[model samples]
Target: MADGSLARMGPEHREEAWQRLGSDTFDLVVIGGGVVGAGTALDAATRGLRVALVEARDLASGTSSRSSKLFHGGLRYLEQLEFSLVREALRERELMLTKIAPHLVKPVSFLYPLTHRFWERPYTAAGLLLYDTMGGARSVPGQKHLTRAGALRMVPALKRDALIGAIRYYDAQADDARHTLTVARTAAHYGAVVRTSTQVVDFLREADRVSGVRVRDVEDGRETEVNAQAVINCTGVWTDELQRLSGSRGRFRVRASKGVHIVVPRDRIVAETGLILRTEKSVLFVIPWRNHWIVGTTDTDWNLDLAHPAATRSDIDYLLEHVNQVLATPLTHDDIEGVYAGLRPLLAGESEETSKLSREHAVARVAPGLVAIAGGKYTTYRVMAADAVDAAAVDLSGRLQPSITDRVPLLGADGYYALVNQTDQLASRYGLHPYRVRHLLDRYGSLVHDVLAMAEGRPELLRPLPAAPDYLRVEVVYAASHEGALHLEDVLTRRTRISIEYPHRGVDCAEAAARLMGEVLGWDDATIAHEVEVYQARVQAERESQDQPDDQAADASRAAAPEARPNVSEPVR
Candidate 1:
């Protein structure tokens, strides 16, 4: 199992990675730790190449983490006649659900509300039938049509006027943050040296070609140069800034689209299935989260603060006003439990509207040794990663192997299905409730045993946190031990949903999370204090910013908080 096992994933073991990164040149050095970067690192490493993945923050701390959390085939893409895109996404979705990450990805059903009695049902069903046929994968049930009474049964919160009928279709869902971490850890498992909180300060050039990156470890003040034969730039929205640092004119501009989502308690709108509604700009989703519903998403262009996109009051109002139209009992500001905003990296075009620009990705050879990839959806990240690596591989003269990631399965995926069947026995063994065991199975799958191992020694790790009762203390501790959770915010916001699940927004539990993380990171009292302060300030800033009127006020309010990109923008010396 030591041939790349979970035991090796603990960041504490590689705490001094910066010291070793400069000691060698890698075959490939990935510039971002989001899904695409992590996937590229894994793909390259698994194909017998030495790789290093660096990120300024924890994995998926951006759009990868703040997604709709659905492995959907973009039902709207059907209407646009992007059948190729839909087919590709559905194939990837099937791979994720069936083979690649059976542990992390599970199917979820959504009710497509049919406003018109006769026309919409048949039309939507025809689209879904095409979707089911396109994938040629049967990991989930096919679409089915239902009458008004059946639709009401699925979504009782919807008003009688909201729909005359509905079509039920399945899409896979995942814990976005956890899945990203799993991808990175899987990359590590394949001999890729992946490190987070390591920012690429500047590019290392050899003659006219960009050779590698000069990176700084954020944990300490040390700097390291990661040399690579070819560098694949998968930095997402920061594509232009990173390429310009190499003094090469970027081929395409990446425009940022700000999408905001709100989380509310499940009781606020009791729905048997997730609801998808047609919006003016884009589609709206009311997803069923753990005891809560994730209602969101306003699509608008954002030009400022790519790191911390704020949810302005107008954005919140737009979402509420749209969603409340269908709800029998409208969800007001008081009903909201949490709010999050993320920027979609869209390819810039003649129009200023971010929603209209292509979600398709672009790859360019900025210099002799660098390939920059930008503007792609999370679901389509694998193809983008494969393409970026393939393009960069052209710079290498050797016979490189073709991409095999389509057949790759992530960690925790090997024995997942069987584990689901034995959930009762596993629960008895762990001394947890049946439902709690099922929850763990859904979250951790076969690796539930790995999670329970900590509790075997401590016994008390089985207990739940005080402020956030949904997660166990072991999960918070394990986040640091396995997942590279550097700060309290990573544990609260990403590792767990406490940041958005609890009404307090992880404020009351910040200190507790800090104390748990301190043990793993060897943090002193001052360090713990600083982590808690930064996390609290972030939550406060997000809340305050969300109350503001427009994007400008929201940006100003969010600026009051600590920045993710601390000091990379200064002219490179």
Candidate 2:
């Protein structure tokens, strides 16, 4: 691995990456830029292998950005008697909290209310006890039993009759998109050629075995061949499609399960800790976001569009109905700030229900030089990546090194705690509030200086955005300049999350953000205006789709919006 390689992913860097992709024959080429894909690239690159990571869209543009944003062992999985999966996930959570990404991953407490008169507390406590001890390393506190009054005191928004008792447990949470992007950047730092808006059109073959891939630049329709010894398919929901494109029969099938989530104002839910409620189908979580509460998620089969999964009116109503059961004041449609839907790539089983499908990942050598991995939780992405690289080792000729990513911290993780201790000094130096400095540190860690450095001469860039005051104007510039944001949606939705956290859903700041991005990307006036119009249309389409009654209608409405990446097309069948 190249020590201290440049991690900047700006436009100039992207051009270099494209040139490298066309000329170099890599040891491994990882497809998909989601968390697992990014993790796979990091794993391969750190092993001193020549690696290249290509994505059709921006990093975490799909399911990775739309997760529940937690790094916990699945409590429900414990009930399902999947102790191994839960234990593995818990170990990964501990790694993320203490070793991997302390800046991005943080401890979050959740209250599980009890409705039954007896047996519920002990039954739940037994599970929590196992959960706390399974990981071997203890970072967060264990579960605490509480009476209904104590629970109500902890969560004043809960109704008096909602729970007889409660059990509060600790878990870790982070911005999934930012975390994924950091993994990709860390891979790039280790000499991995990372490029987005580059789509794989077909598999390149030598004799009967898979050799490499033919990729197209989605922005301009330029095609090139990326030769590699082995290619790993890490596409989550699109796993099956890519496998089919390779002309290889996948050993396992990936089924798409739609999970919908709604974002509401934090004040609407008066809770010190997040809430986890029991639903008829699965568990419901009211997760605590920065200034909002994220409540979701219904597990239903989805066979429609994979790129943009639409959340129908029924899906939103389902979440509101379940969450309102425990809230003192019921939430209505008007209370919602934003809505998003993502598809889970589940390993298909005999059971028809998507919830019943396995959460454990499966890796198989689909072809001589091609490996496919799918059906795993976000917490266990590193493990999945390591396993995938291990499977690809057969295709590689030389003696390969073992995975050392567990010991390797992400790019910004170093000196984060020290930075937190010096927040006041940092705020003073930057001429900003300590709170804003703290926010920047959490998002950028030691690299916060890299972000602040962009405003050396441009002082106005440090100021807060007019429409979304929570995010600074400099963040929009940083997204385009360093975060591999090829389009305006990549900035608003994944890089800054202005698309979901605010009431206007980033519409009010579209023009401002587009112009800021244009300055870095060298967009003309017409290009800036087109970007704003496209982003606004996307927001409007999402709103319209959310109002639709069913998935079919919702998919049609959402698909009507123009794609930001003009040349992106479906995979070749």
TM-score of each: 0.96, 0.99
| Model 2 residue pairs with clashes | none
- Encode model 2's per-residue lDDT on 1-573: one tens digit a residue: 212238889999999999999999999999999999999999999999999999999999999999999998999999999999999999999988988899999999999999998688889888889888896239888889999999999999999999999999999899999999999999999889999999999999999788899999998889999999999999999999999999999999999999999999999999999999999999999999999999989999999989999999999999999999989999999999989899999999999999999999999999999999999999999999999999999999799999999998887898899999999999999899999999998898888888898899999999998799999999998889988998999999999889989889999999999999999999999999999999999999999999999999999999999999978887643
Off by over 4 Å in 1: 1-7, 563-573
Point out the worst 10-residue segment of candidate 2 by lDDT.
1-10
What total of clashing residue pairs does each candidate reach? 0, 0
RMSD of 1: 2.0
Angstrom error of the Cα, residue 200, model 2: value is 0.2
TM-score of 2: 0.99
Give per-residue CA lDDT, model 1, range 458-557, as digits (tens).
Answer: 8788988878888889988888887778778888999898988887999998898889889888889998998888888898999899899989999999
RMSD of model 2 against the true structure:
1.4
Please give the lDDT score at residue 533 for candidate 1.
Answer: 88
